[model samples]
Target: MSSASLKRLAVAVVAAAGAFALAMPTASATPARDNVKDKAEVIGKGKEKEKTVPVRLLSINDLHGNLEPPTGSSGRIADETGTVVDGVGGAAYLATYVKQYKNKDTVLVAAGDLIGASPLLSAAYHDEPTVEFLDMLGLSTSSAGNHEFDEGYTELKRIMKGGCHPVDGCSPAGKWKGSKFDFIAANVLDKKNKHALAPFYLEKINGEKVAFIGLVTATTPSIVTASGIAGLKFTEEVAAANRTSKFLAKRGVKAQVVLVHEGDQVTPNQSPDACPVVPGLGSRIANGLDAEVDLVISGHSHQAYICKVNDPKGNPRVFTQGSSFGRVLTQIDFQIDKNTGDIVRSSVVADNHVVRRTVTPDAQTVAFIDLWKSRTSAVANKPIGRITADMPNTASASGEVPLGNLIADAQLEGTKTGGNAQIALMNPGGIRAGLTYAGSSAGEGDGVVTYGEAFTVQPFNNLMQVVTLTGAQLKLLLEQQWVGGPNNQAFTKILQPSSNFTYTYSTSAAWGTKVSNIKIDGQPVTDAQTIRVAANNFLVGGGDAFAAFTSGTDLWSGPLDIDAFAAYLGAHSPVAPPVANHITVIP
Candidate 1:
């Protein structure tokens, strides 16, 4: 299909999807947390003897819609053993545990990325199938993630509404048969109205008042397209949570927990069997917390660990982020008190269970998943194509990687109006999974790329859009990689470009001034000529605050990066590039 036609298809689907898929729940009609009593809507002013009022708090993050098991990372990680972790993640297996443990007092929660930036199995149907599956899994509430903005607030609203249908877009909200989980976005305020899209939510568990405050990281604007979130204001996560806590307090609720799409850094010595102090982005939020919050469930950067964390304030706060891809279930069982309308006290327990698909899919949950999986089976199980070899998402410990190169090439080639530009830039974060090579060792053109492999790298369904930029604009694009200020203490994974283009820079250079030596096809990168560039529409629109790139000319209408790569791989299926990958990050 022509790029223009694909662009039209993308636009029409978005708008049409908006109408049905993006529909939001009116306050009163939104489904209550699953298993909470239907008629016991409002609790009485006072109820005592709330001893042992156990509320099974179940949390999952970065599910990324891997309905099947996922291959995990191997290496040294924050306070955690970094090694080749086993490939043990699958929603089917996750379903088994969740369903097996279902009871009257359980509350299942997801921090975010429950949708968006997902495998073709789920993203293919615009993530509705995943939503359907989540509904079956009993998702009581979910926070927003940066990837949620990948498709914009509109489509997210659709996934929540059950689908964007009448066409193949979204399924009807009614198809959910009345699920009360609210897609909460406490920090996401309306730019026009200066109000929130959806604020703090209260879930009455065991007749005890519990509130969930959902917020993505404050850095959302710098990572997602401003246009998609144009009318919304993403305030600071801490401030937003604080604001919501006050509101919940006013509503006569006390026990509260934060469901964040961020993680933190921890030491390898935190635990012997497990990383006691989990490390990195999302998990770190609990390091400094304040307020009467009891627990926090964090995610977004896909890693796993547990700790008796303290919130922004010095009070005790137990936070956990189960690794993404159904690798583990972070469990924090709580003891509630109805009289106090809060958690009088709490204890924590966490384990990263391997979601082995080989295990018998739980009977009831599998039945639920089976029904929907069957409905979505047409695409869910359909092979996009196959690989003759293994593809690993490995960037050697030194950070250079062939997988990154292959994807960059795919995007560069896929987006072109059919020219030989010899340049493709890919953000490392987009590469989702590693494809397993068929043979044990690597040699020759022994491995191949599959449709699944392509999907893993460019899973967001972000279309590959080509643009034109001057040397200055290209330089600006390269410079936006570091984030925050040079001296800023905030931790971040610098943006990795998808192409072979390399830049020499001083890691010691001040932030915002770090990139230099722009090169193309192995020569000094220049500013005098116009260079054709490729990126997901999000990045093209200044997503990640790369306003300079968005300033360039849109050379041609784009196709979802994954689809483009899929077509590219399909036309030339077994794409096993030379093992000596192109990415070279020099300090």
Candidate 2:
């Protein structure tokens, strides 16, 4: 059938099936008991059984909706020789690489963050294009990353099951068919249902059953917006994996792999293919998992590494992460013993391959991408404002960056009318990209900032909120940036304060005493004084583990963050990077 006709048929089916048609099960969603028996096809019953069956696992993580090729630092990758290569990632090129490496025995998977924090080409349409692209590429399964909860669990369900968005309705391409791949999150329990969203997916390759168990980080609640995960519970990763592994074993399936959305950062100069011996969250989880799990695929730190960590049983297991934004693909080749239904640990060979731009682009992906680009070009290309110079997202010694300052100032300005806002705080994690003085892939002149460019920087579109907080509470909030705080962030998350708010911190000071010399509008802040502060909805709801924001009162919501940022740039044309002196750090 022609593409248009196929779309029409899909729309018709959706219309006839109603809004929840996608929620219905497909052949892939067979019941667990039946799935095990049906998929566990025992091969070679004789004593001289077949030696082994080769299986290839291809995986990617943290895609973040770069349907088109990313540019600048986001698109660059380093080869084994430590030389950097650029202009590498785009759906077209990535599809080409997947096709080159894929075979009938290959199973494709992802470690999540596939759609959130996306660029305009995908985000403008609510990431439907990305889901479609993944379907076309034949993704079998994936773990739920923290960003997957950005839009809340209900929206995530819509993304998985075919249906028009409850709020945004159907896309221009017609009804959504959800994703062909199953999104398994064994650790994320639905409070209402008391079960996992989709716990584990069992796939049979070469007559051998392999179970893929998925889990997001236990800290998911702290990183994602509180409201998005209000009805869910994130359990400890190691415990969750162990439980799932044991459950699979009971069902006569011994070959198990974990697709988790947590990872560690290797040494700065480490090559993408290097298997570092470093210890971090990923390594710790790997070391703690049940011995039945043979391989672990991870992401969320956006770093690349392939480490062989010993499990609790003192067996060496593979733990790997592919860098974010389609820059790398992790390939694992192993053999499953026909006699035992377990992986041959010695046969496991894993490597991270760069998705190079040298290959011929896939024609289908190019056409799909071009169609969306043209549809979004009008709003994406329209100039929002001009910048005098590049305002990169690079943080200063104090963890304050120019773009963060600009966003905080914008929030303060945007909320002033409705909120009597005094100071605005921007989370460093919310800033996705930098605004270059020259145009980006959206194609505009030098210094021109397009709507698409601004969208890329603040992709969350969180509502701007102004809340009332006492000076004492504000101080506690600042102190929460340390390591032992509620956030549990490994590094200090120095909040980017508006220009009017200034403070000094000492690295050597005790946790609660690190921040001092606080002032707003040139006046010393007194503990008893009440202040109206502006922040995104995520912040006010205690996202990124800033639980202190939850104590604020008299909340006032304003425009979307991206709109506020665009308006700020327009009002202040020829905008230059702000000075990095707002935050002071001392040894």
Best by lDDT: 2
lDDT of 1: 0.61
Q: Which lDDT tens digits does candidate 2 get at residues 1-587?
A: 23333233223321231222122123333222222212233355662466788889999999999988776678887777767777777789899989989986789999989989999999888888998999999888889898888888878877887799888788889998777776777777664333345566777777777888888988888888777887888888887778767766865778999999989877764678887746778888888989999999999888888888888888898999999999898899999998898999999999888888888999999999999989899988999899999888888888999989998998889999989999999999899888888766556889999998899899997999989999999999999888876567666687899999999899998888999999998899999999999999888998777888899999888899999999999999988889989888888
Whole-model lDDT values for every prediction: 0.61, 0.83
Off by over 4 Å in 1: 1-52, 72-87, 166-180, 194-196, 265-289, 311-313, 346-359, 364-388, 418-422, 438-453, 483-500, 505-517, 571-573, 579-587
| Residues 238-347, model 1: lDDT tens digits | 76677556555654557888888887654432321254553555544565444577887788766666666655555666767776777666666767664566775544
Using all chains and alpha carbons, the TM-scores for the candidates as numbered come to 0.79, 0.91
Winning model by TM-score: 2
Error of 1 at 124 (Å): 2.4
Error at 215, model 1, angstroms: 1.6
lDDT of 2 at 223: 83
How many backbone clashes does every candidate have?
57, 1
